[model samples]
Target chain A: MIDLLEHYAVAIMAILLGVVLAMFLVLIFFAILNRLWHNRGISRKREASESIQPLIYSYLDGSINRSDFAARLKNKHDITATWESIEIMIDNLSGEERKKLQMLLDLPPIKKHFLRKLNSRKPISLAQACVYFSKKTLTDKSIAVRLSVLQEHSYNVIAYAATLALVNTTNQGFRDMALLRFLLRKNNASMAVSDIIFKYYDISDDKEVAAEKLEFFVMNPDIPDKTRAAVIRMFPELGFYQTADTLRDLLQINVKNDPTGELTAALLGVLIDFSDQKLREIVEKHRLWESPSREVRLKVPGVYADIYGEETTRILLGLAHDPELEVRMAAQRQLLKHRPLISESRFEPDISTEWRAMKKSGDADVSNG
Target chain B: MSQKVLIIDDDPAVSNFIKYRLSKKSYQVKHVDNGIEGLDAIRDFEPDLVILDMMMPGVDGREVAEQVREHGLIDPNRIIVLSGKKMTDEIKALFDIGIHDYIQKPFSIDLLLLRIERALASLKSR
Candidate 1:
């Protein structure tokens, strides 16, 4: 028993010593491998920095554009340090060198940083930065940044930021109108646009600074067509009389291409507000009251009422007999307001029970054509 | 109970208009500027009805509605969606999430109050 115990003790000591030695060797192996990896990584980074130095120097010297810088540095991998260096380089650039740096910094990351900062800060600097970048003809990036801001921020912030940013760019007045349109595209956002109009234009009274700005935007062809179309749509609300000829031209041109009922309706609304004599003349010439587009038909009566006053019932009497059910329904609504006093001649031949008679007519027209 | 109603919209004008009208009818009203505060106020104020605006920064009104339903915070029936823009898909989306009524902006205050009264009265009858 004593001999067996002695052998067991020796075996235990050997196992403990073996484990300690193995652990020490393993630790040393890991430490060496880690050191080697660290050295290799450092050397690779240094080599990369040396390789990127020319691009950086060129960028700082104002030879390359911002998009190219973003593309070149995209794969440079050391984002944090790289951006810091780029920012520092941007700060040192002189004259046109500064412009080039500004252009190069127009990448998404830089813009995203601006967006983040704008959310928490006053945004005046970001707006100025955007304008500075925009003047260098950075349309693609500038537009993308502006759109993102529009989609993601409060309308007030977007309006304030975009308005300031547009001040230095070409056709800046037009850009503001486009931004407003984008901001206020949906049914819910009309009120906000109206608020902006009220704040800027006093729309109800027909004398607002915002109205003059919109007029300037309309006259600027340097603005894109889409933005122009949107501004034209808002013209009636602002009651810009100078655009009457422009509005008539647009309405005539627009009627040829499916008569965008909503826009026509809006234009009609404006002309009604202005009580322009030309409005009735154009409607009579185009036969817009009986036009295929429900949008135009719905709009005609309001203008007719506004132009001839509510007592002049001739156009409304004619409109009441129109074939398009929606138009007839709209006429009916107008007639209903005058109520009990409506002439028997204006009574429809067929008062169909279908609730969506106008909707059905629209569908039929679409299918037949 | 005061029949308290809360409005959560980013548009100050909208929230103010609703607050002013609802208070005139003697309904206790509270307003919050965005969805995050809106959610927090729901817990603290515990309004009888909530008028939610659909679009906002960070967390939108739809997500706020979803959170309310998932957590059983506000009664699903008492929520009214207020928007200036109308998209059928959005309406269907809100409907699927359990919003009971919707009102478009630039509304007549009289019409809105009537709808609220009807919705609340209908709920009581149920």
Candidate 2:
């Protein structure tokens, strides 16, 4: 019985030893796989560096143009790898090697490409992109980068980028609606389409072309009312002088007719752009100053005052004593622009208290009117 | 002689109305929906006059008018174009293509009758 028990114990010991050896083998296999994976990753990175190595060498040897370097770099494959490799090469270059690179960059294409990359890639910020693109010193890459930035997600960045693109286009001696449409569709951002339109009136050198494009915008009902109003304001740039009547028609028919407060203000801005003395009299005669819609009275009327100064001043003075606090406040604010040497203390009314009183009076005035 | 007229228009309502009014006025008329059929009907019927609608689903009225003028079977002077939309720069191209007269859409039936009468009377005089 003791001998049988000893044989069974020996068999169990052998089985346990075999299990331990299998476990050790599996661990070793896994460790080898993990090491192979790590080495593969390192090799891939090295291969990428080697692929970009000649471009870096060419840059250091002064054999390639800057523009050519930039165009190749801009191609988007292994950019980070190539950039890092180039940096290492630049650092390792001796004084003579560095001077060769400097001389190579002086080549036209080299200078153009390097400057373009500097403008396009140097600053990551949208605002920086806009400013860099707007600079006269920038190469064409600046304009190209600016266009991409105009389609940026940030509103302010888009606005700045759009403005830079527009100014650049204008500097290139072309005026067209294509740029406007491009920016609007891509950015979905507008500080004021109308504001840009208004600026075109004075800035566009060709009257016929400016008129033709402006007419197309006004006729196209697809554009928003604010943009249409801005386009109407630019009619004066068409040099027809007959645009005043067309503007008046648009203001009366397109804006005031719809009863949209924002559009009314936009039309009023168009009227201000007209700057005709006769229209000022019409405002005075109609007693538009007393209208209850603060938009019409305050907003629209203020724009009128800005253009027809003395008459607007008289109209605003009457509103300064208006029963509606909003009307009074708006009138006061409009008056402030015309007031010279005016301090903040000269016109700081108790806004909180006045706001309540104005609300009460505004309701009362609406009922009475 | 029954002075036959063919109306080529995409809108059924317009074609029917014109056909009904002209037939009531005692003129024989045939109507077709598209420009191709309108041209074929003109060739078959040899109508004294053809009233063509400018905008159509296929082979627009302007192209039909050009084809008719090209065939020389129908006199260019006898064709009148009726368009529902406003006159645009494209109308100049129509004029160059031999469309004699154009009447904008939502036109009064009375105005159309007058135009037809004037055109027929001028043809008689010629």
Candidate 3:
């Protein structure tokens, strides 16, 4: 019995030792693979960037002909890394240079490669593909498949990126609405989409689609009030003076809907860029200083400050003694800034001298505005 | 001789794009990356036109303009302003000193070229 037990113990111990050795070997093999895989990715990206930079610069320098450039792009493999390199290269460019660079993406094989990767299981691939699309203009038909997934995609960031790409791709009114429709669904990211639309007014990578298209959306009583308000609020910052009259109309409608008048106030702030006169006219139209919303009332001083005249000064002075302390202080500040030392200074040569001196000698630190 | 143009911008991409576009029209374009280098290039290149970018680190675009005006290196008519942002009230002052045109950044190369042609033509028309 003792001899049998000793043999059994030896067998069990050997089995245990063998299992430990096997695990150790497996772990080491994987560690080597992980390192090698990581190194390969890094090397591939580095090689891709190194290879693509020269062709881009050469093209930008007018050295390489377009046909040769297109041919070179077609022959280059590993387009995922190639897309990344192209994205970084063209991120800051616009105009003819940007268009030329973006044209490389229109090449058949590469566009097919990226479009195919839109369904990629890898999140990184999906995100990168969307970014390239974001920068490159896409035909409506090209983006229709991507648009379907935008509303249903489980991945919010990828969806947002894709939505931006769709918006960037086309300026057609129906297409924009389609993009907006997918964006506005009762998804968790609706508010986020609203913020994105407000902030990135021109990421369209193209010029405005006609102010009327946006104006029509804002005018449609069927759309959500918040969306219309955001649209009007964005008009001033968009540098689309074409929408100035549209904004004035929207401002009237917004104040009527939300007595708090926050949207009206915000639009009035940027409307100064289009017309100080128009801004003043809107303010006088609404009698905004008397509006119940303190935010709207506070905007009055800034608008008043924009128009220089005794009438504007008198209006500001009236507010300087108004009931709301914040409104009073803002008005006082505007009045102080425009105070003329000489009665005739508005037309005086000395006043002109001062204005010129101030305009010429900017804040010492700034290079551009 | 090719028409001489100097482009002073902090962004190499922009400068190179301008250079490439203008070179096609046979303008001899030289680019400098910053304010100091821009100042030096103006004197050295004696360009027929200077495309000045606003928003450089030190010796900023305005400062470069001021120094150029002070030195009489090139007339204000020879200068065309480019800005990454809106030309603020202060930067607009450069217009009075002879900035022939203002082209906002991210502008179309077509627009920049058009403005360049206009600026040069203004000099010719005078």
Against the true structure, whose DockQ is highest?
A: 3
- Clashing residue pairs in candidate 2 are A66-A110, A67-A109, A67-A110, A67-A113
Of models 1 and 3, which has the larger DockQ?
A: 3
Backbone clashes under 3 angstroms, per model: 8, 4, 3
The true-versus-predicted C-alpha distance at residue A245 of model 2, in Å, is 1.8
Q: How high is the lDDT of residue B111 in model 2?
A: 74
- Please write out the lDDT profile of model 3 over residues A87-205, one tens digit for every residue: 64475456667778788777777788877778787887787677667777767564656655653567877776776676665555534755556435434344555545642455544
TM-score of each: 0.37, 0.33, 0.61
Best-matching candidate per TM-score:
3
Candidate ranking (DockQ, best to worst): 3, 1, 2
Using TM-score as the measure, name the better of candidate 2 and candidate 3: 3
What is the Cα root-mean-square deviation between model 3 and the actual structure? 8.8
Ranking by lDDT: 3, 1, 2
Q: What is the C-alpha lDDT profile of model 1 across A220-292, one tens digit per residue?
A: 5454443444556666545467777766766666565543465566667666766777777778777777677
lDDT of 2: 0.60
